[model samples]
Target: MDKKKFPVLIKYCFLKGKNTVKAKTWLDAEFPDTARGKSTIKHSYTKLRCGEMNTEGGEHSGRPKEVVTDENIKKIHKMIATECVHHIIDEYLGMRKLCAKWVPHKLTFDQQ
Candidate 1:
């Protein structure tokens, strides 16, 4: 109820009363809401901080460009080029046949 008590309340809530003088001074200067009243502050802070509201021009917001090094491009090319020889042969032969030592198959078909 008393004006002096307001500072004490803020000091108790924000800084644990270690520096009540500084806490009261900061609170008065900033006019910050009580911690209990921070739901509105939180929404505003998040919108402004994340540039969702577009109030600050969002100098730090956007999708970053994908980073592709030479090795990464080479790896991607190799991945696209990779193929299962058995799958290719089966597609063309119309049968499941082993054409090479590396082509996998059931143990019964290991002969061919």
Candidate 2:
């Protein structure tokens, strides 16, 4: 089960007056492979009881966040317009339109 489901289960068990032991047991039965520990259940229960269960996760800061804005979209559009797709493909992928043919010469042991 997902970590998100744990909070919902904890809330349910807490609402049903189930202790940590029973909650852990239920979790074990529900998801035998991923049975949540007592501490995890207790912490979630405490959060639910104390009305601090933030489903979206509490905010924390470290790395700068990146988001696409209208300015970025306009800049991308301008770049695409200035540099057409054919030139970009030819520059990177070496694809070009040409009219030509290969003429094979007679093979000889000396040529090899």
Candidate 3:
């Protein structure tokens, strides 16, 4: 690559001091200014309704004194980002509906 292209390539690579690069940072680095400007998000609609998610990474350790571990926070982050809870709820609800429709209700156990 030419000297002029080195910086552009590096910028596209998302080199944030080291291998530790946030997904947002990587996206911003890869996308152009115009593209980034156009990528607007509506929190009311885009935000997934999940109350179990916590941003603080200091709640993972079992100890009552030690701050939360990084891995625990990462697990939550992955869960929220992938919307795993939503999928799980969807599956459970569908199964429940199917069960309600197919299964018959009985007031007396004599039929069993």
Q: What C-alpha lDDT values do all the predictions have?
A: 0.47, 0.74, 0.40
- Cα RMSDs, all models: 13.7, 11.8, 17.9
lDDT of 3 by residue, 1-112 (tens): 2333433333333333322234235535655452222122112112222332222223465666645789888988888866765555545443222444532233248645
lDDT (10s digit) by residue, model 1, range 28-90: 565645422334334444444464433322356665566577887998877656555554666
Location of the lowest summed lDDT over 10 successive residues in candidate 2:
98-107
Better of 2 and 3 by lDDT: 2
Candidates arranged by TM-score, highest first: 2, 1, 3
Local error of candidate 1 at 47, Å? 14
Which residue pairs show backbone clashes in model 3? 58-68, 59-68, 60-68
TM-score of every model versus the real structure: 0.23, 0.48, 0.18
Candidate 3 lDDT score relative to the true structure: 0.40
**What's each prediction's clash count?**
0, 0, 3
Top TM-score hit: 2
RMSD of 1: 13.7
Q: Which stretches of candidate 2 lie over 4 Å from their true place?
A: 61-112
TM-score of decoy 3: 0.18
Candidate 1 displacement at residue 16 in angstroms: 10
